[model samples]
Target: MTEAINDWMAGFEARIADLQRKSADLQQNIAASGATATSPDGGVRVTVGPTGALQDLQLAPSTTRYPPAELAGIIMRVAAEAQREAAHRVAQAFAPVAEGTDAMRMLQEFLPPPPEHVSDAPVDGLPGVDDIDEPPQPSTPPPSPPPPAAPPRPPRRPSTQDDDDFEQPW
Candidate 1:
């Protein structure tokens, strides 16, 4: 009986190992395919690697007017948003490999909770931590453009010949 039990445990351990290896591979794939997030209003943009490291930032000209404190706050918020997006994307990209298993749960261990909701819904059904969804599509179609207009030219006026050419210093 003891020998039989050992054999069963060994098989279980091997199965777990196989699952773990597959999970690691899925993670590597996700890391290779990265994600980025940017402020729609063009205020800020940030990119994060799959490992959640800060990769890059681009700031709009308008942000230059902000004081250091305010700028820092905006940067922090933007970075957080970017990171959240990256995490969500990673989870999503790996979903195919992660579904119906514990892999997705393991992936969540790497991500910090969102500021408002602490649930792990993003990767709940995937094999890895889910990547954030891409921002929603714009609702309305672009407005029909008006016909192009000619550029305006400055108004011209005739000069009077009797106008004084010189003025007194006093």
Candidate 2:
């Protein structure tokens, strides 16, 4: 019985040490993580830390051409992009520890969804413009003729009554 208790105690100590090491690794990974993004026009850049906090911002000299409102909008967009990237990095860093656990779901809930892209192509598997055998002719309907002009109206005849006929006694 004494040997069995010793073996159990050793296993418990090893588990505790392993847990501590993993905790340290996780903390290091989170501390070292950050992400950056720039505006499409390259006028603004933003950086965010692992917890999605803004860390830095940079603006190009040419950004002065934009109005204050426009500049502010661009900065907001860039910052949001950077935060999303940072969130993704943090999620990846925690993935190993969070696997097969509810922590992954909770982490995903805190992150923003990926951006959606718009495509001009047709939904079906039809050939595109370049693959067409012949250009499609526009099927515009014929324009209706203008409405017929209204008939002319007869002229009004002058009044035959005189102003003296309308006079009344006081």
Candidate 3:
């Protein structure tokens, strides 16, 4: 019985040491992680840390041409992209630690779903203009009838009282 208990204690100590080593590795990987992204126009760049906090932003000289609102929008877009990249890196770092465990499911619940990828190919359900090859010739429309002529006005009557009544002061 004493030998059996000693063996169990040794196994338990080994498992604890292994877990501590893995935890240390995970922390190191997470600390080293970061991500960066740039705007589509390349006027704005953003960097994010492992926890997805903004670490830095850079703007090109050409970014001055953009209006304030547009610049703000570009900055936000680039920052979001950087944050997504950081989240991806953090998830990758956590992968080995969480694999095949309930922690993996819990970690997935905290992470955002992967972004949907857009394809250059036209949507399957909709018809594309390129599919038609040639533009359809429009059918000739019927000529519209001319507008009806205006009705003729009656001829003016000749005045009998004339210019003499115009001189009276009333």
Candidate 4:
């Protein structure tokens, strides 16, 4: 067991060294290339240092129309999006050295493992089903066929109350 642990530790140390070297490369690339990320709406621009620090920000002219609080919100949202993109780029750049290492395998542990086996037993008779005695009830018998509806009323004829004032011009 101790030998197994030592082996794992050795692999872990190698992975760390590789990550450090990759980080150095990433820093150099960032310094040379000066990565810039922009918001989807093009309303904000963010510049980052090689070590992933915010270097600068540029705001669009249309942002002035918004109220002070709203404008601050917009800027914050845009900056957050740009920062995420920058971090993604950094991760992607480090992928070459980090892909197959123990560190990557450790990350994979966070995901739920696949089921070892599937049972053929029915769900209705499961052990906990008895605890929940209140099964769903059906709707009220289709409203009792709507009480056979009321009989239709007869149409009324027009009244002769206004005919007395009319003149026949035939």
* Model 4: pairs clashing at backbone N, Cα or C within 3 Å: none
Ranking by TM-score: 2, 3, 1, 4
Stretches > 4 Å off in candidate 1: 1-29, 109-170
Q: How many clashes in each structure?
A: 14, 0, 0, 0
- Which ten contiguous residues of candidate 4 have the minimum total lDDT? 120-129
Query: For model 1, how does the per-residue alpha-carbon lDDT over 3-107 read when each residue is reduced to its tens digit?
Result: 999999999999999888878887777776455665534667788887568888888896665567656765676677777777877877687676766888887
RMSD (Cα, Å) for all candidates, in order, is 18.4, 11.0, 10.9, 20.7
Model 4 lDDT on a 0 to 1 scale: 0.58
Model 2: CA > 4 A from native: 116-170
For 1-170, candidate 3 gives per-residue lDDT tens digits of 99999999999999999888888988988887788897655668898899888899999997776667656766776677777778777777788778878977777677766544421112222222333554444457789999999999999989887676767886
Against the reference, the lDDT scores of all candidates come to 0.67, 0.75, 0.73, 0.58
135: Cα error in model 2, Å: 22
In model 2, what are the clashing residue pairs, if there are any? none
Local error of candidate 3 at residue 55 (angstroms): 0.9
Question: Whose TM-score is higher: candidate 1's or candidate 4's?
Answer: 1
Task: Please write out the lDDT profile of model 4 over residues 1-170, one tens digit for every residue.
Answer: 99999999999999899788888986665455435766445666777654446789998885555567655655565455555555555555555656888875664454333323322112323222223454433335434445677899999988867666667663
Q: How do the predictions measure up, each by TM-score?
A: 0.46, 0.63, 0.62, 0.41
